[model samples]
Target: MDPSIVREIHQIVPENRVFLDLQERYSYSYDASFGEYLPDIVIQPQSALEISKLVKLANQHRIPVYPRGSATSLSGGSLPVHGGMVLDMSQLKQKCIIDRENLLAIVSPGVTTAEIHRKAEEAGLFYPPDPSSSHISTIGGNLLENSSGPKGLKYGTTKEYVIGLEVVTPTGEIVRTGGKTVKNVTGYDLTRLIVGSEGTLAIVTEAILRLIPKPPARKTMYATFAEFVTSGVAITNILSQGILPAAMEMLDQQCIRAVENFKPIGLPTDAEAMVIIEVDGHPLAVDEEIERCAQVCKEAGATSVHIARDEQERDKIWQARKNVSPALAQVGPTKISEDATVPRNQIPAMMNRLREIREKYQLNLFVFGHAGDGNLHPTIITDKQNKEEMKRVEDAVSEIFEAAISLGGTLSGEHGIGIMKSPYMEMELGEEGLRLMKLIKDAWDPNHILNPGKIFPQPGQTKVVLTDE
Candidate 1:
């Protein structure tokens, strides 16, 4: 960057806020996802006005501005692929107010999701979008990805709770969409548009999130099935019986064995599958619902059903499920996690397809996810350094995407389409559909200076190629 450009940026933001050291720039190079591209400069703007001015400067100089939170994205959502200036949004942590009267949370982009959950619960209110990385990820990242976790089966995603936003548009204009009220149908739903835009549409400075009353009580149960297919049947039966569990998570035998190996939890390693179910509401209703769920699992060929009698027992059951990620990390050097979701009824079919793909590719693939919502995480554990093996892993990944699309599902349920899944955008959304989305991007950022090389595929790119260049 030119010295004049740095001087202009320093004018907008203080000299201390602008990071130009090589080592400092390298820290903002990559995110949780694959690949790394160092930015020319890194800026930490604390206010919306500062960001607005910086964005205007970016447009004037045709520099790509990538707004980033904690960089916990599984997809390459925050990677500075274009190698311009990276705007670290984690420093803008000033606002986080709980509007108890309106049941809303007005928060800054730097506030962690876990903080929001803690504050909401403290006020006797609830925010249900709980991603696995909520403890570390920022609300800005969650809003951009529209991420949700187990509670999403009933409570919905981050997009549902967000009612308004204070955004810096691509053209450096500060705009406010929606308001404190939940019911707003004024015109274009810019709030929804920007919520899941992956920072391609605009930069969010602050957000107003809607909240609901916390549930009074909850019950939990765990069931082990002799066969994976039977576990799917058990899920279908539980839902069919009108017992809408707050969360219905399933794990394959590989996951069970991995967990048992990592930390002995007395889980049935021999069982083909296991599901942990939970229900929340009034005490009596939760008790009855959990019993119904246990009964359905038993009838659906579950080998064992364990109902939690106390909070400790419930936490024990959840602990086994939470151990799956770390346990699987022990299997291989590389973990390619894909969340290919299908229709609720097609979960069984999707499982079958995954089995075939695993056997055909001869790769160590483990499956688990929010079964109640049909979002399965088919993670492939392999060494990326092995060229031949990575080829098979790439093929397996492509097949998983195809299986989900064929079953009338999407390429991603929670993870946004960063560069990793951009190739398959047209496969899921036809050429015309992808074009319409590109049109929206073009209209929002005419200079294409915000988080380029994401969500849209380059010309003639049709498959995922993970091998070295």
Candidate 2:
């Protein structure tokens, strides 16, 4: 970058907020996902006005501008792949207002999802899009990825709660989409378009999120099955019986053993699979629903069923589920986590296909995810240092995507089509369909100055390239 450009940026934002040193720039290079491309400059804009000015400058210079939040993106959503300038949105945390009168929470993009949940609960309201990384991820990133966790089966993803947004367009124009009302069909639904766009379309500065009354009571239960197929059957039985759980999570034997070894959670390591189910509603309703869920599990061939006697027991069950990622980290240096989701009925078939891929590749692939919603996370634990094993891992990942699409599923459920999945977009969306999406991108960003080298694949790119060398 030219010294004149840096001086102009300093004029737009404070000199203290502009970071041009190589060390400071390196911190913005990578995200939670693998790969690293250091941005030429890192700017912490504290207001939408600052962002608008910075964006205008970027557009004038044709510099790629990557908007980033807390950097907790699992799909490389916030990685500075093109590496021109990184707009650190985390420093824009100024607003988080819970409008109890309208059942809405107006928040800045930098507010953590967990903080919104806490404030909403304090006000007798609920924001239900709880991704696993909510404790650390920003609301901006969550909206961009449209990420949801176990509760997606019942409450839907982040897009469902977002009613309005204040965004800076790719060309540096500030625009507001939607409004506070839930029934706004005024114009093009740009709000939904921008959300889940993975920051390619625009940068979200603020959002108005819809909230519902918190559930009065909730019940949790844990079940272990001798076979994964039996666990899948139990999930189908529970939902088939008209019992909609708040969350239904499944963990395979490998994950169970990993968690047990990590923290001694007392899980049944011998079991082929374990499931945790939770129902939330009126106290009396939840009590009856939990019992019905337990009976359904037993009928589906569960070897053991444990209903939580209290909140501590409930936390114990959930804690084990939460420990999965950390436990798996202990197994290998590299973890390639893929969220391939299918229709609820096809989960069993997908699970079987995943087992086949695991065995065929001879890799340590573990399976777990939200069973009720058919979003299974098939994670491969391996060392990227081993070129031979990484080649197999790459093939296994391709097969996994093919298996999910073949089973009438998607390549990703919550994780957006970041750089990792961009190469496979054509496989999922036909050529014409992909072309239409590109048209939208071209119309919105003519210069291709915002978040370049993401979502849309480069020429001749067809598969994931995992070897860093």
Candidate 3:
């Protein structure tokens, strides 16, 4: 709120992009996390140069700046902590260079993941990482979170597809890492490090993403199980059989019924769990794999298996999965979704223990996620305004994190340990492990102004030495 800082903001970005109006600033106060923190100012920079200038001014004054793209994150990663300024990246949307020969594309941070997919399809190439929030989440936010979607099991996550980056570090120094070319390891893989820093390391300006040829054929299969464990067993059996599916997802009966309310997609209503598997390749190859997967599903004790006959049916199947998030959300005004991932083989045990917790806490919880990779999104729906209920939800979430670690799993699979998971990070990684993290963070961001109060806990609260002796 300083006069000089206000002047610098206007000087950097155009007057039209800067909003000092209280009502407008109030609108940028929260994200999809159901959390709120009103920022004092909101800046929508039109270009990378403008962004750098604003960052410089914010850092100089030690004002907290939260970088947000679409603000569709599940965790409160984009929520402003100290309430200074929010750098809205949505206005910086731009996509160019659909280089088919190089199999890559250059895009601004504000570009949505789905936008890139549509553009890439026009160029006959494919950019594969498809987070469930692809329609609303921005490319920069996806990079910061290292988001993974259904196809992540086969194509890999954001870290694998990001070839290079043009990022502005916390000090407002714009630095470029990597290039359009793929497969380069001349030194430390800093590009990968920045990929999932959740905006704490830097503000990604633009990105160069790796693209592969679009698959010629894809077949989808849905199987219902009498028991949830059997569904999980099917996932492990398929992978153990050396059949890499493009996507293998699972949803318990509660999740299925939620989706069935508004639009019935022929999903088994009485089934304990359901598994949706997709295989893609050449026509002959895809067909053979689909048949092989069907056999594996049966061996794992599936009650019935249904394979989509055409593209229309395929879309319908995915539609159900896409709506699964919103469907489970209806249980309460606020949905608390956590990403607890165990190894593929341990998925059955994880799912069983989750059910036990739900019964113990008397929670009406619904569980679903990418079963192929053992990442589950156990959603706890509750009215955030209900203080008593909220406390119970918090305890359940803490226990869930501890349970995941006890199963030899980590706290998060895709969603980073933002403000929501930072407190519980020690449960998974002890003080010694966290110490090493802080050392690296301090080396890059000495001021701790960029997306401060994220990833790790506050200073003095952590045993991690910020200095290199």
What C-alpha lDDT values do all the predictions have?
Answer: 0.93, 0.93, 0.85
lDDT of 2: 0.93
Q: lDDT tens string, model 3, 1-469?
A: 7777888787788789888888998899888777677888899987788888888887788888799999887778998878888999988857656888899989899988999999999987888999988888899999999999889899899999998999988888889999987988878887999999998888999999999999988999899999988888788888888999999998888999999985787788899998899999899999999999999999989999989999998898888888888787666787888899998888888888888889878887888999998889888887777777776777788778878888899888998777778877676779888888888888887878888878786654432211122
- Give the TM-score comparing model 1 with the true structure, all chains together: 0.98
Q: How does residue 132 of candidate 3 score in lDDT?
A: 89
How accurate locally is residue 55 in candidate 1, as Cα lDDT from 0 to 100? 95
**How many clashing pairs does model 1 include?**
0
In each prediction, how many residue pairs overlap at the backbone (N, C-alpha, C within less than 3 A)? 0, 0, 0
In model 2, the runs with Cα more than 4 Å from the true position are: none
True-vs-predicted CA distance for residue 225, candidate 1, Å: 0.4
User: Highest TM-score, which number?
Assistant: 2
Off by over 4 Å in 3: 459-469
- Give the runs in model 1 whose Cα sits over 4 Å from its true position: none
lDDT of 1 at 69: 95
